[model samples]
Target: MADPIKDTRRMIAEMQPRLHPGKYVFCSGIRDDLAADVANVAKGSFVEDEGMSFIIPQEETDRLGIAGGVAMRQITLMVRSALDGVGLTAAVSSALATHGIPANIVAAARHDHVFVPADRAEEALAILLARQAEAQVGS
Candidate 1:
């Protein structure tokens, strides 16, 4: 099997994700302190099978006084890694951070999802593309 981290460059395309930044929200049935507290809903249900759970930015969450909450943003790249390694996350995060882009990483069994701010979507794509190119050239 190909290494998840090493093979990611070939598995996914570098995309310039377009974002329509507006009011939005999502809910996870499984609530935990680690998850963002955007809003509290007494009704409705969430699907836990979906690898990561997060509520997008919504007016209700604002009204509920959620803090440390991140606004809905764009994800320039979607990558999958069968190998769940902490080292890969840190390395990828460090690469993005070096370019002054904040990456919110969520790891699922089959892949790792990275969410970047809508405003920085273009720059984020450039960074990832460059990284992919570098990997290609090096190999």
Candidate 2:
């Protein structure tokens, strides 16, 4: 993988956003009995006051009998952005918000994933593409 991008403009300019297939929903599980199941199934998770908030496949919610809200789709930013990179999330969210789309971002080892309402996934991808195009010119 290439060096993680640090410059905001360059990061945006090179970010090739691609939609990840399938729908995902957040589920909460904190019981000791649930740890293995969650660790095996959750695509990602974050600790929350109520429980362990897990982003798992929508199907798992049904299987696990857990309540989930707002089906979301992931848009993976191909740029390998530094974990401490500045402004990338703000730029992404700002661009999406301008079009009335909400973005929930997760930064992993190699890329940043943006989760948008499933219904707006395609539109969000387009907006990111346009933002990247504009940034390319600026870079």
Candidate 3:
């Protein structure tokens, strides 16, 4: 794998955000015993105070009878960003917030993922792309 980018500006300029190709939903209240089962089917899962929160495909949500809310779509930042990198999330979230889009961010070892309302996925993408373009021009 390529070295993770450390420069905040370059990270934003080359992040190459890509939208995952499906609708996802947030489901909670999954019992610990069932966490493994849900994880096996979910695209992403996180532990929360309420229970395990699973970001699962809409189809699986229906199939598993999981209570889902706020259908969302994932935008994967294709930059290999360092775990301790600063400013990337702030910049992305600020851009999205300016457009009144709520962004739920997940930072993994290799990349950052943003989940936005399913209906506003394209708009969110446009904002991110524009941010990147502007960063490139500035640099």
Q: After superposition, which runs of candidate 2 have C-alpha atoms over 4 Å from their true positions?
A: 29-35
Write one digit per residue (lDDT tens) for candidate 3, span 1-139: 7888889999999989999988988788876776777899888778777667778888887777777798899999999998888789999999999999999998988999999999999999999999999999989
Clashes of 3: 0
Per-residue lDDT value at 38 in model 1: 34
The runs of at least 3 residues in candidate 1 whose Cα sits more than 4 Å from the true structure, single-residue gaps closed, are: 1-53, 57-68
What does the lDDT read for residue 105 in candidate 3?
94
Model 1 whole-model lDDT (C-alpha atoms): 0.52
| Per-model TM against the reference | 0.53, 0.92, 0.93
Q: Please report, in order, the local distance difference test score of every candidate based on alpha carbons.
A: 0.52, 0.90, 0.90
- Write the residue-wise lDDT of candidate 2 on 1-139 in tens digits: 5778899999999999999999999767546776787669999988887867889888887776667789999999999999888998999999999999989999899999999999999999999999999999997
Q: Per model, how many backbone clashes are there? A: 3, 0, 0
Considering summed lDDT, which 10 consecutive residues are worst modelled in model 3? 44-53
Candidate 1, run of 10 with poorest lDDT: 37-46
